[model samples]
Target chain A: MKKMLLFVVLSMTIFMAACGSNDAEGSSEATETEDGKQIVTFWHAMGGASQEALDKIVASYNESQDEVEVRAEFQGTYDEALTKFHSVAGTDSAPTMIQVFEIGTMSMVNSGHIEPIQKFIDEDGYDMGHLEENIVNYYKIDDQFYSMPFNSSTPVMFYNKDAFEEAGLDPENPPQTFEEVEAASKAIVESNPEMKGFALQAYGWLFEQLLANQGALLLNEDNGRSGVATEIGFTEEQGKSIFEWVERMNTDGTFANYGTNGDNMLAGFLAEDVSMFLQSSANSRDLIDNAPFEVGVAFLPHPENVEREGVVIGGASLWMSEGKEEAEQKAAWDFMKYLQSPEIQAQWHTDTGYFAINPAAYEEELAVEMHEENPQLKVTVEQLQATNPSYATQGAVMDMIPEERKIIETALESVFNGGDVDTTYQTAIEQLNAAIETANKARGE
Target chain B: MTNMTAVITQEDQALFVRTKRKQRYKQFIKGILFLLPSIALFSVFLFYPLLRTIYLSFFLTDASGATTVFVGWDNFVTLFQSTIFQQSIKSTFLFVLYTVPLTIVISLFLAIIANEKLKGIGFFRTIFSSTMGISVAAASVFWLYLFHPTIGFLNIIMDTFGLEKVGWLTDPSWALIAVAVTTIWMNIGFTFLILLGGLQSIDKYLYESADVDGAGYFYKLRRITIPMLSPTLFFVVTVTIINAFQTFGQVDILTQGGPQNATNLMVYSIYREAFTNYQFGSASAQAIILFIIILLMTIIQFKLGERKVHYQ
Candidate 1:
């Protein structure tokens, strides 16, 4: 019995030792050679096709310069990457640079752990004239860029051309306003009783975009840019109209409620269960490739009475971490600058359907070829260019944006379930404001 | 001569006492040495985190998990007052109610059927036990495909039966039931295996005696099988209840506590608080409350169930 006990104890110790060996090794120290070359780590949330493009760009940059050897790592999705960044912010394991999504911009700015890209731009006397004005406006705070916009996209309407033709609607003339969308949807439903006219995931981003298209603020204090917003502005007339329209659509059987799953909604559209849908421009490639019928692309519909304002960007940006060695920071900036170059941006745009942040990328041969092959790719650029840069169009900046988005999503779900719109929005707004206040208190802001 | 004998007896007694104490000391050292690793591991992974969670529940924390200020009982107070948290508790209990009894009934039925002496019983047993081999994530994904509203197998079957297609995931009324169905399916393999073991271990004599008396199958089952299986049923019930309370993956993957928070289980609420909202203090408080609730539930189950378990 004693021998058996001894053996069991030894085996357990060995098992624990084996388990201990699997922990990740500590971060490597940043070292600079006499030639001014430094090693930097760049963490990003790009995955799948986007990840391939990011890898290619990183590889090319590594081959192009001897000054910086960037080791790019894919760190899951944007939320996951930000969570990891928060966990390791003060630790040595924190990446020298990280990509943060648009919603996380406020959090990153308030984090105080980042070196603003504006500082590097000013130090290098780099001209920002080539960058798209509207895209750059998103990451800018108080006329200074907090991070560099990498891949930017705006929401647009995608329709099935075959469905439109079959429904006897003009394929070339898609719905340009909410009223027109309703009319066209009615016609489609009457003609084809089997298919729904439209479908969209109950995503908060779409609601935000719709509000922006109507030139309305989603949060107070000029969309939380001039001051910290204490309340949501989504209880305004435009917000109510948007909700009423969705509720009406659902009631009329003109809208397919796909819940909040974007992929499932996309599948519904691709399978032609719905004639039209609204999704990010980044899905252009997928629709063009995988869609069974010709995919028609158009600007997102606005309310008939309200003039259309341009949509806010939905992708993420690259932010450099603070407290790193100056050489490493500079190396990270060089990679960011490399990413924004016209050739690389064009390739990125072509590879992933994300709109290139550099307007000059449109002039690149690859981008021109891509547009020639599929003109829908050019519509996103035109739509962005037409956007009037204003506080509302810049999108909301709030530390509690994620929570607020969740609240809006919940409100939408409730409204869909025949809940009173005014009551739902009021309750949601109150809850959101309370949450914001609590977060501010927690942060001691 | 008497004094010499007394001194000899005292010396012998002293020797015996010393040897007994030495043996006990050796045994104590050996036992402690054997348990040291487990104690260390438990302290590091379990006990320390539990203590820290309790400590954190009283303080407000920043996004990076740094404590900013001491809030005393504010976190717990806010959680108790929040309607969402209350709804989550109700939803969790509803899920437990939906899954536990159904899982017990279905698995018990299968176990009895598979317990019969029939040809290819092993194949049928393997078929019923296959889900245990599937991971929660894989199973949830499979269920997601099967539960898709428009192009799913379930809806297709409903269509074939001339039934209206119910939005299994989208509809608020059906979402929780859909998730419960997936969970019940996932749990049956485990519960079935345990019950089958219990079924097989019953002495053949009792059933043989019942057969000689011309007792019906139902009579024999009620009199012999159920009583004999009571202990195993008790264990399965306890385990299933605990597992049901901690259901997170299916709700997260399927509904994300949505369709108006109809499926927001308590554990999912804790996850959202800590990870999504970065409210560690509130999350820790919720976790402690959940721990208490589970503890109370298990205690009640044991109290009510142990007496009914026939150990013979």
Candidate 2:
């Protein structure tokens, strides 16, 4: 009986400890610190090389100002950071600001969790005109700015110039169409049967980019800009083309099946196991620096018949939480404006391969020198500028996009591993529609 | 005189009944006092959340987990209809089948070997039980590197042996097995340690009597070691089954329920639905079902397994 009593007391302590209020311990960290400076907590999801560059930038911002000290925290990946944000929103532990991916725009708005940046812009009389138009277009909904565009990128084809030459193809001009890419893949395989021709990382973002390149919308309601999206807007022809392209590559044994792992696809590229892949332009710096062979960056490919309409903007934007103190908001606002300055944007553009939202940063000495040294980075910017502003190219905005991406990712994987393209594509669409409806019902729509 | 005597006896009976009732009430209050803290803790952490989960199952929740609308049994109906959830259920059972038996058999084998009275046997015991010290996240990360599609140790070995490279994490056919292998390796340490402890606690005289009867080593092991170890084996099996059913870390780190949702275990599915999809209603429904299944499994195990367990 005594042992049982002791056990009960011990377990009670453990349970109470587990259920203790977390905000009390967590909230005290980011509110303020020594020296009477309001600390603006900024939660971001930039990992790896980008985290290093971002930390340097945040540190410089702190040194530049005396009143507001900006604290930047790396909060895992985009999905993980968003989940954490939702759990902590409306709590004392919530950050003063957060960097959310482009797809999270609608969800963030509907969540009623964020203070739109437009109010801050208008109050400060800030200039939104100087920012990149295509990047801004994705974030601007209902003629209002929900988030300040920070780091932006687009899909670009990465090819091995050495392999292209080995295949007796033009090293300077990479393949510009699916048919041409298939032919090139065959040539590269003929040159050396061991090296695979292409690797598409069963990723959904690249699929969206390809769909937009063919001028197809991914969601209804004009890519969910007019109102809530109801279903997939892409026609069978538009969606099936991508699946068929992957299937053809699979049949030819030229597609390296990396299956939704970007890291492996990248390693395959660096190891010269696969010749070409489509990834975010944000990877350009890492690829150029690490690859043993010369890396060629090209515009995203469309089908043989459709005109190339360009790619959607990828990457995250700065969103201020709704209920932060006025002082913290001002501090975060200052940092946001500081980030868009030519000098900082130039540094960010060179350090990471993301676009400088301030197009004037292109003329900054740092950016100019980097662009001259590696013109592949300039191709990324050119693709963004070349993009025709349309519902398709502006990208889809839906809370369900993250879920939808998984559905499409699974379909892509099935095709990569010899699943029939037509049936797989059909099932994917049905699943996507069902998921959207479920999301809508959850929202009480 | 007679009336006075009768009244006094009735009064004594009344006093006796009143005292008995008062004593019983005081004891009940004392018992409740002793149990108060435990009751409060259980209600706060376990019971409240369980009730809330059941309540939330009958409604639709938004991103903030507020119930936006009452959906009745729609969430559960949809879950049963979802092929993804169906696959998740099948994969979870398959995962259990793969990991639990293998973990027990391998750990039992290692325990018996390490139980030998030999030189430097402590080193072998430590090595066999080393994985208990490693957290699931760390172990999964380590195995993720080993099973990486590119720059993986396993693939490197395959390449060296002049064999075809396998997509250990990427292929649907291999991903569940890969995760199971990691789980088995991580679980071996605890199971082996417990079984080893049980083996050591067995009476030396049992083996001595067997030896006097000219019993062989294997015979002594079968009769003495296994039967004596049955109670510990039962406990180990129960815990391992529960742990296997609740596996989330390995699948999250290694696969994220990809390669056609092949590794989407039940807990991971609940997580994806609630946290990822922000459908707390559906997630809660899944959770309630999981709770029922585990409850039934444990009860069934106790009923049947306890009969065979030889507790000494």
Candidate 3:
């Protein structure tokens, strides 16, 4: 009886602990209210040192305004933030501002959950010339802006200098073309049998980049817009080249298939065992700080057969929720304009190694003066400017992109696991088109 | 007659005092009513959400949050049509099929060895049960690093001995088996303890009687030990099957149901549908299917227990 009683007590304690509220714990004290001050909640998903820089900027913004207060909250990862936002947006109380990813912008805009930023710009009479040309264009739906562009980044090649020198290759001159990259990878493996030659995000993000460089359209008819209902053609002739390369790497033991986590490539690169890895430009700050050996940045490799095309932007943007009161809407506008300010944009770029969408900030006298000392800040801009603009290579706006990505990742997995690359790619195209159709129908697009 | 009446009155007075003491004990318990607030909290926080989920399985949500059209059987119909959903259900059942029997047989074997009256018996018990302390997420992460094809420790050992590295998590054929191996390593300890306890609880007199009847070790184990341990074995089998069906944490952490959906169990697919794709309606229907499976399994267990289990 005593043992049973003890067991019951222990089980109850465990259950209560699981049920206990260890919630947000209220970190900030209530600010002293003054006349005309409105507190605006802003939920974002940035963390680590990047979050610290954001917090400092928010503090400065609050100090600058006696009429508005912006309180930035750190929500969990990107997916969690979206889930939380949906849950809270229906209530009487919801955040006035949110940091949504670029992929989510089209869905949110179509859902009518957010207001058009073009309306805010016209109402407030903000100077259009103050923003960058490409930056302002990034938030367009039918050529009308809906969100304020914030953090912008593109993919680039990051390589280990030590590994290059060890393989009898020039560290200063990284691979500039696809053929050179393949050759370098083979050389690196032979030089060091213990090390892997190449690694990439298991998802088809890398494959998309390869297709873009080849100047091929992945999906037809403007990639699933109402005017153009083109089926997926990534399994066609040009796409076969990429799959063939994947197979060659897998069978030759040069390419290591990391499970479908982005961290796999980052971990392998940081360990200095992989000679070359492809990742986002936003990792520049982290790589500079944490890499044991010297790291170099270069433009994404292009094929020798054709000219390179523009790669789509992969970072996030800010969206303002609809159904907010006039006061809250005005507060959201103020915060949006504040983020797009030249000074803040430049600071954001320098702090996090993400690209500043305001191209003027890159060449303005003060910015130019600052850049003369640090030339590495110019790589993303150079990479972006040297490409031809085409819709097939432009940013994709497909509904159910997440599901599409799952199909691509599965295809890549099959290719890396010694399956027939042609069959896998064909199967992926068929699967993804079906998903796109389903999502488009559900969304009433 | 007067003396007898006086004695009866005294005895009645004593009985009245004992009854009064019992009433005081009841009042003492009532005085501890401050704990009602906590009980109310648990009922609201934990039990309420569970009941709400079961209730919510009947509804549906569209892409936009504003529209919640409750089509009772539509979601289930769509879910049943999905090839991926069907595959996940099949995979989950296969996981249970592979894990439960293997776990029971291995644990029972280990328990029998540990239950032997020998030197260092306590050490063996502690060593066998230590794996219960590792969380599923932590163990999956460790296994991921261990099985990484190129830079992993396992591959390094394989290279040393001139063996080709196996694609443990990447190959579709091997991914589910890899996950099962990690789960088996982590959970076998807890099942071992239950079986060991059951083994110890058997009355020694039966074994002594069997020995006097000239029974060998295997015969004693079969006739004397197996029947007596049937109840505990039944409980372990039911719990193991339920746990194997709900194997989400490892799949989420280690594989994410990739390599062409080889490791995609129903729970992980449900999570992807709900959280990743925001298809809450379909996800809820998948969850309902999982609930029905578990309910049927439980009923089957109970029915089987009534027939096969012997009390003595």
Q: Which candidate leads in TM-score?
A: 2
Ranking of all predicted structures according to lDDT, beginning with the best and ending with the worst: 2, 1, 3
lDDT of 1: 0.87
Model 2, B28-89: lDDT tens digits are 86698688887896888899999999999999988879999998999899899988889999
Q: Best DockQ goes to which candidate? A: 1
Which parts of model 2 are misplaced by more than 4 Å?
Answer: A1-30, B1-27
- lDDT by residue (tens digit), candidate 3, B124-164: 99999888888888889999888776678987899899998
Model 2 global lDDT (CA atoms, 0 to 1): 0.91
Q: Estimate each model's TM-score.
A: 0.90, 0.94, 0.80
lDDT of 1 by residue, A89-198 (tens): 86778899999889998888877788889999999999887888887677778889889889888899999888899888999989999888888898899988878988
- List residue ranges in candidate 1 displaced over 4 A: A1-41, A59-72, A323-331, B1-36, B205-214
Query: How far out, in Å, is residue A105 in model 3?
Result: 1.6
Model 2: CAPRI class: acceptable
How many collisions between residues are there in candidate 2? 0
Task: Write model 3 residue lDDT over A324-349, tens digit each, in one string.
Answer: 77787788788877887778877777
lDDT of 1 at B89: 94
